[model samples]
Target chain A: MSQSTVPARGAARTSGTVRIVGAGLLGASIGHALTALGVDVVLSDTSPAQLRLAVDYGAGRPARGDDEPRLVVVAVPPDVVAQVIEQELADHPDAVVTDVASVKLEPLHALRARGVDLTHYIGSHPLAGRERGGAISARADIFIGRPWVVCRDAETSSADLAVVEGLALDLGATPLEMDPEEHDHSVALVSHVPQLVASLLAGRFVTAPEGSLRLAGPGVRDTTRIAASAPELWVQILGSNAEPVVEILDVLATDLAAVADALRHPDAPGARRTVADSIRRGNEGVERLPGKHGQNRRFAQIVVMVDDTPGQLGRLFGELGDLDVNVEDLRLEHSPGAQFGLAEISVVPSVVHGAVDGLTARGWKIASMPND
Target chain B: MSQSTVPARGAARTSGTVRIVGAGLLGASIGHALTALGVDVVLSDTSPAQLRLAVDYGAGRPARGDDEPRLVVVAVPPDVVAQVIEQELADHPDAVVTDVASVKLEPLHALRARGVDLTHYIGSHPLAGRERGGAISARADIFIGRPWVVCRDAETSSADLAVVEGLALDLGATPLEMDPEEHDHSVALVSHVPQLVASLLAGRFVTAPEGSLRLAGPGVRDTTRIAASAPELWVQILGSNAEPVVEILDVLATDLAAVADALRHPDAPGARRTVADSIRRGNEGVERLPGKHGQNRRFAQIVVMVDDTPGQLGRLFGELGDLDVNVEDLRLEHSPGAQFGLAEISVVPSVVHGAVDGLTARGWKIASMPND
Candidate 1:
């Protein structure tokens, strides 16, 4: 990835050599961004091939014997995170150590049980992940605009906490301070529970008749998209955050049973009300998600029908540019054998009027123009 | 919606006057497509406001008593669908009648219990729906490239089935023949069950701490997108098709409990295996979805980092046209305050190499290039 021309605020906040314990996706991405900020980064991993691949990709240089890192960031998977943090703290006595595991309390509890020194360790998690993992899929901008939670307690000094926070800042992530318990509970609700639910729902499709799947539309596809996740990885994440996840799923099961009971005897008193309340609660829940549904309201969409041939879209987009309309998002939909395709373009509401008028002036078929 | 310039195959397959019993989204959409094919269409609805809105939108004209329809299509909600179908059959004795309700068995069973003459009646479902309903959201192309299920019996004549199948073909839908029992069971797995699961999962988020939702990403968004559906509409759909839906949810609840038990005791023997199997089965189930993940496998993606400025996207799209590469699908992701946006463009696998090289040669920053 090329470095941006924008001025970076990273080098001022973070300095000296940094060591990354795992040369996987998160580790290599941190190295890429830090290296772009003109910082010295050293990366190491158990697999020699993976380490070499990350190093060869300019993530960092090979570890050297004389190198004294100011910070040691452990980016190992969940199962080994506690052990790695314990070892890193022992090896780098003078350095502040932080591990970016999803569940915070589990590893902290494991290290506490082992009687490891707690003064220099902080548990953190970046709420960012891709379907594909490893250095091959790593990008410097993976963490931009994502929430990275840093966990600290009475044992942590402000300076040590700053080191971890600075690392998050230099990588263009918003650092949110959360205690270990709060961090684990939050992720359990958002990430771990959703993963388990997707798996459970998609599992039902395994034995479904072929005719049932033939009727599959965008609705079912959207619900099961995350079901294609790596199974082994999810099992660890779910297991580590079991208490909070199980607590939520238990309540969700109660809801499921209530709906099922209502469906079984729809004529019973309050049966229809039970089913309606389930859906109404779901609507309120999704709307409660910050910044999720706001995206649709922030931008207005206009659909234009264009010929499937080349240059047709180019002309429409070019006209949009000439009108000074900045398209915030775009989705192009066309059936496999259909002769026409629809370009659903999302632009800011203020520019939508001008954008539609400009495209219409250029002889474009306005299939559905935004009025707002 | 404007009429397409391409020659239509609809006029030959579907001719004579057609009557639509509801003026909602599906009814108006069907009317729009039929009117475009040179067929005389008459529309009627229980509400005068709904009828006026659809008629004003050029879907069709107001119904007249002297007008005789060759085909009558009912597009009402599931609860009253059977009553409407029976009335339509009696009113238009010479016409073949079909209903676009999502459930097939419920209406057919209701009609049979009433001892209504079954010779002129055939049950059908389009397997199509949108989040919003009513005439305000109707579109002529809603049914294109979607599966439409038509159910017929020994009492039905070939001419009647032909009339119903012609409606599907004229609207660019693939009409598949299935018995009423098969249609009900198939929809229960694909459409009805998924809706319940989404609502159930999202319902858990209602009481979550706001911090949890701040970490929400595309994964949770995708799984819960369908949860925002209208509760009143879903209540009827689920109630009418309760038998098959309850059957599927029963087995899914068992799978859920097994995983929850394993998560509560992760260190126990076979506990991890239960969790792994849950995820593994989900992966297999999603892979079994025909033409879903196949969309990604059919093309290769190349992500280009473009500055968030006017004309930047236009220039890149223009360059794509110059290279003679057809963009099959696209997704543009940008953080709110990020300095740059990533345009993930999908082109057919055969042309990915050329598109990447061409863009890189033209001085664009190719953040990630397609190797497939």
Candidate 2:
């Protein structure tokens, strides 16, 4: 079914009301975005305050009657996402429903084994979020341009897919259709595994001596930034996506073992080869990544200095644009001495030389480019 | 000795010169930075064109007399870095010298075993570079505000340390003192291991079916950007830093195994715990990283969109400054659609809400914050 076949405004009549079961970040945000588009949204939450906050935030109005909505989006904590989805399916049999959860396969399988109505329900995960949570944080364009993966099973009706896809488009997001297994596996590699690696690295420093962490720099930050996410939330995500995530981590472990053995004895030529092989592999991995706008496939570096002032760095970027150098990537390092900061700018190799020269000529001191 | 006691400009000493043998990217860049600071620098390279290019680039002039410079920096491909450092040291006695190779312990041991003058020699590596190579790519500020690590040993003299530190300082870099072993180990964890992981992930796609890579996004790019580096250069670096790198990879591998197992059997409770543990650990690791400018550590997510217009982004940032939000970190995702891009803005969480509201109120469409 095309989007035009659905109601143009205030929710689709055929689907009844669109009831948002939880008033948290995802649910409330969805309500807000949909409401802004003039959809009839009714929000229900266990917490009266949260529900009111959702309404206040313009996500939706409180449910006034027992009338079942055509669609119910269950957006709760991951551990509870499956339960909420299951409960909603039971509570409102006629409503075509879905979820916005990180992990999908297990939830789908659980519902399948329990023989929940598969035609009216689909699984979805909008690959977006922040460190903060709640309805107050909701925005209308939250999913804009992000990938919203829809997990479709054999029993999923064409109408179900259309509803989810329409929702994605409504929020300015792209819909990516995939099987539950593929979705789980892909996220395991990209999201779950990476999150674990970051957390493991970050955890190492929790027990470190004082000065040791003082030396931690941008690399560590880049590697572990995701680790700073809410622990309870992650537990839910990892718990649901355990299998695929573990598989990738296992592969990493095997590689890690080889590397460790080599490090213990570098005199052996084979050890050197092992180490070189790994680094080479990493180099290759980095290259496969798409460049800015998915144009070039090479990674660029951005380096700049941070000053003590509150907004000095922000202004520096403003200046960079005046120079017309498109920065592909950036990393920052603050020097030990007072009053100095360093920002690394990674751009296309084609523009690196010019950007360096331009920035230097503009009177902004360039920090780490090689000197000939 | 305090920096104040060191002569602001060492008397234009006629003392023996520092012979930089390779005149390639690392060699020439070092020479250029040094020459700009009035250090007596002599440039040499196997390629005459490269030698001339070094001169044109202002790295240094050819050595005029037979007198060996007080220091010799052998900046060559990793495969030849050790050989070149040995050759240069053999050619220059009574001169304090160092090699700016990425890996350290091996070369230091190699020199020791070969009976090179240890008293005047140290193993040093400046944690800096670009994907491009050669003299033309060099910049005088290559090491400025970057870490120039001096790997010391019993043979390394205080004077040698001072000289290397001076070079780093003059180049506007931070001089870090470390034992050769410690330096190798630290870099293995921070640099070499990351390189390998990136490569391995990228290599998975080197043989990917056609068009599969076109769908690659920022996650892949961020993970694989370092893969585009010169392969031969990395071979040498990994070869030298093999032992420690391998060791770290082993630890990582163990973590990977646990993750893999969890993925393979999601229903198993232990698997869930393992995944959660990994993520938690990553969170801890991320927190250990030092904040920019030695300030309170906080993370900022920057969101922005790129329009097809050449400088539309430039204008957006130019306007950002007027709103008074300090952008601590920024990431832009390129989508295929016309007239739209995805920009994620990370600022101090304390101010991110205000910034988002400010941007939205200004009619700039903002992506939903993660929590939202």
Q: Which candidate is the best by DockQ?
A: 1
lDDT for each residue of candidate 1 in A1-372, tens digit (9 for 90 to 100): 223322253534679999999988889888877887788999989999989998888889989888899999999888999999999899899999998888888888899999998899988888887777888777776786678899989999999999998888777678889888888888887788888888888888898888878888888888888889888678778888899989987877777888899999888999999999999988988887765366667888788878867667767766777687877778777654467777888887888778878888888876665422
Give model 1's docking category: medium
RMSD of each: 3.0, 5.2
lDDT of each: 0.82, 0.67
Instruction: Report the lDDT tens digits of candidate 2 across residue range A269-354.
Output: 79767766766666555554444523633745545545556776667777778778666545455554535556766565667677
- Give the TM-score of each candidate: 0.93, 0.82
Alpha-carbon RMSD, candidate 1: 3.0
lDDT of 1 at A180: 83
Candidate 1 Cα errors over 4 Å, as ranges: A1-12, A305-315, A334-341, A348-367, A370-372, B1-12, B306-311, B336-340, B348-366, B370-372
Q: For this target, which candidate reaches the highest TM-score against the unseen true structure?
A: 1
Global fold similarity of model 1 (TM-score): 0.93
